[model samples]
Target chain A: MGVIHVTDRQGQRHTLECVEGWRVMEIIRDWGLPIEGVCGGACECATCHVFIAKDWVEKLDPATDEEEDQLDTVITHPTSRLSCQIIWTPDLDGLELTLAPANG
Target chain B: MTDNIETDVVIIGAGPVGLFAVFELGLLDIKCHLIDILPKVGGQCAELYPEKPIYDIPGFPMVTGQGLVDNLLAQIEPFHPTFHFNEMVESVEPIGTPEAPLFRVRTAEDGTTFTCKAIIIAAGGGSFQPKKPPMENIEAYEGTGVFYAVRHMQMFRDKRVLIVGGGDSALDWTVNLQPIVKRLTLLHRRDAFRAAPHTVEKMRALVAGGDMDLHLGQVTHLKGKAPVLEGVEIKKDDGSIVSVDCDVVLPFFGLTMKLGPIANWGLNLHENLIPVDTEKFETNVPGVFAIGDINTYPGKLKLILSGFHEGALAAQKVHRYVYPDKKLLFQYTTSSTSLQKKLGVTA
Candidate 1:
């Protein structure tokens, strides 16, 4: 089991029991945090975008070109990525993800 | 000049096609006044079904109607068109200019006249009137128990919410409210769902997870009185009444908003749709146009994708109507750009 750490915009931190093979968007919203998965994670809509801490970002797999293009359109404080593309695993424990704005 | 609001053009409907016309005409910097009866600019979309997903519209693979409307609003936001809502257009008469002719659009609610050089009546298939529930006490339940939108997600946060209808909108709403509402019950008049495949899959997953209940039949009656909606009585196909307890009732049976004012506007209406020329989507009335599901051309497909096709074509004609000298130059941008725009992901 992987333990994922999610920090919402309101400074609420949640340590969730990350089920294996679950997408990051599902894990966050399942815990009752706000994440507009508007397109239901079809990869067509970029509503479920998030920002991963740079230190742990390299530990995770590189985002696909499609995901990168989606990130380019989003307005982020620093950087943003689509949470639906990230899969949870045991090695990925302590993954710090931040919620993003809806304009992406 | 009775409360005269003058513009070079007046686009009567703020629908997908109507808004597209506004954007297209904006390229020429021709002023336009966009009016819609709904509280929002998106006509049928914002009024009829904001939650339903649109699969036919090209590009983005798939998108909710609300999502598509947001993208459309963003596309036309740069045009900066004026908007007036909650007011119906009562009449349209010629307000002749010394050099050219104009139209005086008189609205009913507020007797204000909007004068414009040209008019594009791109009303998408009549006013979309939502089919409301038959509960007599439903009015008393508004804000107290019932709602048209999911305004207070926390109200139904841990309660059973019953959704009526089997259409695309109904199905999409179930999926949307499923993760939010504690338990969901989808009551359909029929056993089938006209929603897309992905939405159906998600609902099926919810059902498998014991998070939802699917009641396949019609709602017979309401259970409670003021300040509460206890349960709904649904009559199954076998002539049996099944009473299911619920916190809130949502009717998504779709709209009955027929073409209310167009018949009086001097346009030929054939079978509830505006009859128009095949190539241009223009009505019998000069300087007027219609598009989308509300229109029927000799070869019109009546899809959102097709409406975009008709819209771009009509804009070119309207460009010619406004600027007779620029007609030939406007012809270069006249070809069908709907598929191209969607394919190229331009907008």
Candidate 2:
């Protein structure tokens, strides 16, 4: 089990508790956060974008080539990541991220 | 609820690629009928992001998704392809032998079936249905008070409506129905929302002015008798429950796209996508073709442009099985007078 801290575009914070191996996007979406997993975690649409906090950016798995390509279509921040690509584990227990502004 | 259709080609989806397929098939003097699960044509382009601008479509500098769909519909107007909206292609089978096969396509919604010489599966990401909330007795109040969508606004007028979720649908309806409804409550687990920021701002303004209520909690239990809804029990962040009077409950939980009845059809699938030869976009079954996003190839890119190219190539091959006796003569739309006439364009 892990808890993710998500700060929405409106600057409101939500601490979501999720099980291990759950996608951060799924946790945010289930709790009715601002994330729109339009392609349903397919990595085809970048609607589920989030900016990992500076400290936690290096903890998660690196983005894949397909994810990198899809991310190219969106405006990227230095710590930009697709929430769907980030899987929760014990290492990410207190991961902090902020929702990215939609490029759409 | 209508007579069975007999056509030269039956396109399974009414998306842009499927609409374009109608044009391609029409150029070869083939008649087509399209079926889609959406109530209208244009699939994801119109449904998901109609207002979203698409920059890569050929010939258009910048066309919104809906704009591209509109042009495609007009381009295929001369063909007069029949479209059956709100119907899904439930089953597809080869009627004849493998050498010379015909297809029989049926839809689950109604007994409407089609007999065709060739079948084109252009179902982009398959059917898009709203994901129902996972509450236990949610199904019991499905039609009585629970609704995934609002077909009409008047139904909620003068009623205590509780709108759940934070997506575009929920926010849009909350704002739209607040003015007419007797009491409106926009309930979510948090203050954060997924809708357009401007729309959210408007909703917040309304809440601040006390026009509607904004409660931060997740619905835990539904309170009502069978076929009549009364209220909902919400579990707050502090583990406290609050009951809100609600005559109607609209849960915009989101959508789930499945292959749907297409999976039952005997076709080779790779990760739920139809495996088709790149040459003709033909599936393992003869006379049956899969195109658009529903199909997968080694280098398949699920883009509208890629689907358009696949549709053109698939049409050429479909011509062989649809009219085996006629020799196909490929011609550009710019130079072919026959194709121009077919498009109702005369020099």
Candidate 3:
């Protein structure tokens, strides 16, 4: 099990406990943090967009082309990523990220 | 105005669940008309990810999103369901009493009205609309100096236009509108594009020839008063802010699902999902049913298979509304000759 720090749109931070093999999106959504994850972790919808902390950016695997394509559809920052693409692991125990602005 | 379309049932969405509802409702002799905001059917399957593989569909071991949609379309072929595409359902007003409920459904695009005895809200995640960037005061310029979709190309003739995003809509418009527009600028966050290779090639050719301007950046601010855009401030990738002058801004950032007008339909909503009973899958309002991902109940799973079951059960209750005087006899296509005939499989 690992824990992830999530900052929601309102700038409120919440630490969520997550099990391994679960996507970060599922963890955030299970904790009721307002992440849409509309496509149910299929990486089809960019509703689960997030910004990884600069320190932890290099700790995760690089996003695939498919994930990047989905990210192109939304207003993205330099650290923008679809949280669904990030799988929870013990190495990411204290991963910190902020939720992207909700798409209108 | 044309006459309001009269039907036994009016399905709000043309998604997989909506398509399956036609099969169930048709078996009970309930004719249906489906309305979708998209130009084509298969809602998210067709729009979001058509090629994505899906498992857990009861019979098929594995099927693509579009594959399941095609099979559902073929399975419900005998019903000959009427579809009104490119139309968003605007309002649903109950026009009948509680015992015998009827509804007057209206669409936003053409004001098309449908009067039906029963309504099946199979709209999964509401209606798909163009994704709007979360820019301050951007809504003020909508329909004036900012457009999500191009209804007419002539309106942009000889005008300075700025297109945003790296997807097909942005690249296609950049290439197509370059010829007519006095000046065209394409702005994107990254150097790489997610659009079709051919469309990207054409856009590159135009840029190479100096027909249009291409900038790797994102729009930071809309520089204009409400309803009249004079220019825009862009944050380039190199950390430099630049201002580009243009008459209109078109941001094609793909689509997003919104609850839209469904929230104002007087139905009880629990976090954007209609709470339904486990038995009928009907909403709090009589004669109006909510199924698929749009509905919530005890142990709801939001799976495609779960939606199929909800639709089948909902149809049984819909039969009660459409044919209250008649008795509903349980029959199966495997054994009942009448059911076989309804499926057009009489042997």
lDDT of each: 0.72, 0.85, 0.93
lDDT of 3 by residue, B212-307 (tens): 999987888998878899999998889899999999999999999999999999999999999999999999999999989999998999898998
Better of 1 and 2 by DockQ: 2
Best by TM-score: 3
Question: Candidates ranked by DockQ, best first?
Answer: 3, 2, 1
Kindly list the interface RMSD, in angstroms, of each predicted candidate in the order they appear: 18.1, 11.8, 1.0
Q: Candidate 2 DockQ category?
A: incorrect
For B261-286, candidate 1 gives per-residue lDDT tens digits of 77798778886688888677777777
lDDT of 1: 0.72
Shares of reference contacts reproduced by the candidates, in order, are 0.00, 0.00, 0.76
Every model's Cα RMSD, please? 18.8, 8.8, 1.4
TM-score of every model? Answer: 0.48, 0.70, 0.97
Model 2 segments more than 4 A misplaced: A1-104, B134-145, B150-161, B166-184, B189-214, B220-231, B235-240, B245-248
